[model samples]
Target: MRSGPYKIIIGLALWLITPVETFAQSILRDAETEAFLHESSDPIFRAAGLTPQSVHMYLLHENSINAFVTGGQNIFIHSGLILAADDVTEFLGVMAHETCHIACGHRLRRGEAYANAGTASILSMVLGAAAILAGGTDAGMGIMMAGQSVAQGQFLAYTRGQESEADLAGAKYLETVGINGEGMIRFFDKLRDQEILAQVRQDPYVRSHPLNRVRILQLQQAVETSPSYQKPPNPALEEKFQRLKAKLMGYLYEPRRTLRKYPPSDTSIAARYARVYAYHKSLEWDLALTEAKALVESEPQNPYFYEIMGQILFENGRVRESLPVFKQAVDLGPREPLIATAYGQAMVSLEDPDLMEKAIPILEDATRQDSGNTFAWFNLAKAYAWSGRDAEASLATAERFYSAGVPMMAVMHAQRAMESFKMGTSEWLRAQDILYVSQEAAEKLEKQRRRQERQRRLSFED
Candidate 1:
């Protein structure tokens, strides 16, 4: 059975669940969704005097309304929070607030960036480490929590003072970006209503953010006084936000729920997007194809529509049929690496050596741009191996393992790669670098194992 945090599940291929004891949340990853988030959040990051590349935004497959900044430069927003937002401005507002947490350095910094590590491994740098300190479950620990354990205690909740500071800082960011602050206040006003609920019933945002009357008043003052408080909404982003929410609803919600929410009468682009995912995930391929085809007709130029159609066909044993659709998607030259990776993956899946010539360069480029994508690396390895390039295959396999946080496997593959390459060559040096990092990561994991055992013993005694 396929396992680990990086396993490619069906549907739109965004659901990557990270098992952390009893605390698990799916980390959604899609090249297109990530690109949208990066675009929307880039301004706030810039306003905070930070580069968009420095801070990464992650979407959690959580229904609770929460967005948080942790470790140093990572911001995690629950998909539920995105669905809850009334408009794009509200979504951006939450992003702006989280960026403030980073800008204000509300959490003490720890560790350095692992530039090549994949999604789950990246989270392992922060939440995974924090989960370990909390004595996280042993299940899938090797894959999900297999990186440096540098941070402690600060990811879940922030001090009231910090929350207040972030609130004030967030308003300034929206003003700096020439966006309306009404959305910020409106979003917070919704959070304020949640405080009346029982603690367990309240949203995670309320628990983590510590909303007080004074803080809300200060937030209001900071936002309302800004010159950009009444600026018009960006229509394009607003439309995209609707689609984003629709896609999340379709992917994460039950098919029945999704169809009910966006019935046949709702033939809009966003509604069709939701239905396609819902139909495909429900194993109703015909319905999915119909919806996907309609979506392509509605927006012939849109790469994402084609992407969803390709995903549906690719996942449902129609790999050959999906190729032309995926071709159209990549031909549009969408900036999303995942779409290209998916296209490359489809070609490699055919297991035809003749296709390698066409597949290899696409996979190589996708892997180079998105080295952290384990799926891309895995496909590239398979493509190389089929084409009789054992050395390249081994190197790609090493990268896949490293990206997935299985350092021992990575080290082994890296060693294999090294033996195939000449000494001091670029490939050999790359293999050597993988070996070094994997070895160091393995040692740290060994230490973590010992610490976990002690913690288990202490818990048993208690």
Candidate 2:
């Protein structure tokens, strides 16, 4: 499973309920979603009056067009919505709403509410609607609770008010960021319409969020009430958004669907972007390359176009060509950690030791640029080890996996630290307290996993 704080418990439960092969497929993609999440959290946090310094986001490989806050820190975005959104503004709107929950202390407030609800009332509710929301049958509820420990149902049920507040605050943040608050209204409206078209089979974001005339009116009010707002003239960033959206759409939808949705267009680059990803996904190497080459020709100065070039080349096993394309991409958007990571990887693959050395500082800079990036941490660790910096390499590798939400890696490295201390060598063990805590966490998770397995088997017998 992907290295997420919630994964250890969720993974075991999902594993029991889902067939093994299905779960494995999801686990692989979940890792990338987690990485995208780390990359995207900062702006949402900053927009919602929270600190990006410690915030973490994880993308869940759920197909439902919904999102939820599982705990105090983790915001889970559905992969479906991530792929379907029209642009980053739309994606950020979803994130900003969730961020509002964190900023306003919703998790803390939910705990208070759950306590006030008392044990029996919480259990009754959990056995009722919570079971439905969680796909837990009446009997399954007991097994589910055994793993969750806390009242997971109560936590979600009690957060309805918090979700509402988040919508309001998120809209305000969108305005602050100079995003058209209409994006929120539009997106919500789309979801509301979708629920209606599906005859309300969808979950109650529609029912709870009720897209009454008042909702859009309030969003408009928030947008107008905020200080004078105007989206900055950023064609470059907008192009990046388009490209990312296109790539995601291609990956998410069938080729025929993508072609239909993004039909060829000369005025808007969306279609061209879509074609690149669609052809690439189909493994039509010649077609994808042809489309990409044309795009680069049409937009010669657009650095994002070079990013697509680098992606195409690398993905098609042209690592040698990918390196130079990635360099051009970095020149175009040095702040983008994804492009920099790609460049660094290409350098590493070619065994250009000096280039890889150069790439380390660059990758390190990328990690610092987005301290939450697990990918950067992983790359930096590998570069360090290959360059003969064992101590820092271990620490970096541990930290990399640690930030990605995998406490196991943290615990593993913590053990390494303990070993170094035993040797009375490796100056890296100077600060071992955090490592000690990680060790305890890993043990706790192992215990939970064992407990969950017992429950699953017992339930199966029943």
**Runs off by more than 4 Å, candidate 2:** 1-61, 82-99, 107-183, 193-200, 204-243, 264-267, 297-302, 370-372, 404-410, 417-434, 457-462
Off by over 4 Å in 1: 1-23, 108-155, 196-199, 458-462
Please, what's the RMSD in Å of model 2? 8.9
Q: Tell me the tens digit of each residue's lDDT in model 2 across 1-462.
A: 233432222211011112112232131122223344555556657877677755645343455565655434555455566666776666777777778777887653345545654444344333323332322121122222332222222245334556567778988777665665555666776776554556347543443233555555666677666563344423554555565566556655677888887876543576777777677667787777777778778888765677677767776778788888878878877776656766776677666678768879888877766554555667787788788877667777666544443456666775665554444544355326436544554565466567668878988999
Best by lDDT: 1
Each model's lDDT comes to 0.75, 0.57
Per-candidate TM equals 0.87, 0.67
Query: 1-462, model 1: which lDDT tens digit per residue?
Result: 135422323436353534332335545777668878988889899999998887766677778788876545767688889999999988888888888888887863223323323333455554443432332211123334344221112225677888878888888999998888788788988899888899778887886677877887888888788888778789888888888889888888888999999998998888998888788767788898899899889889988788888988887888999999998998876566778888988899899888777899988888777666677788899999888999999999998777666778889999999999999999999999888877876776776667768878988999
TM for candidate 1 is 0.87
Residue 383 displacement (Å), model 1: 0.9
Which TM-score value belongs to model 2?
Answer: 0.67
Worst window of 10 by summed lDDT in candidate 1: 131-140
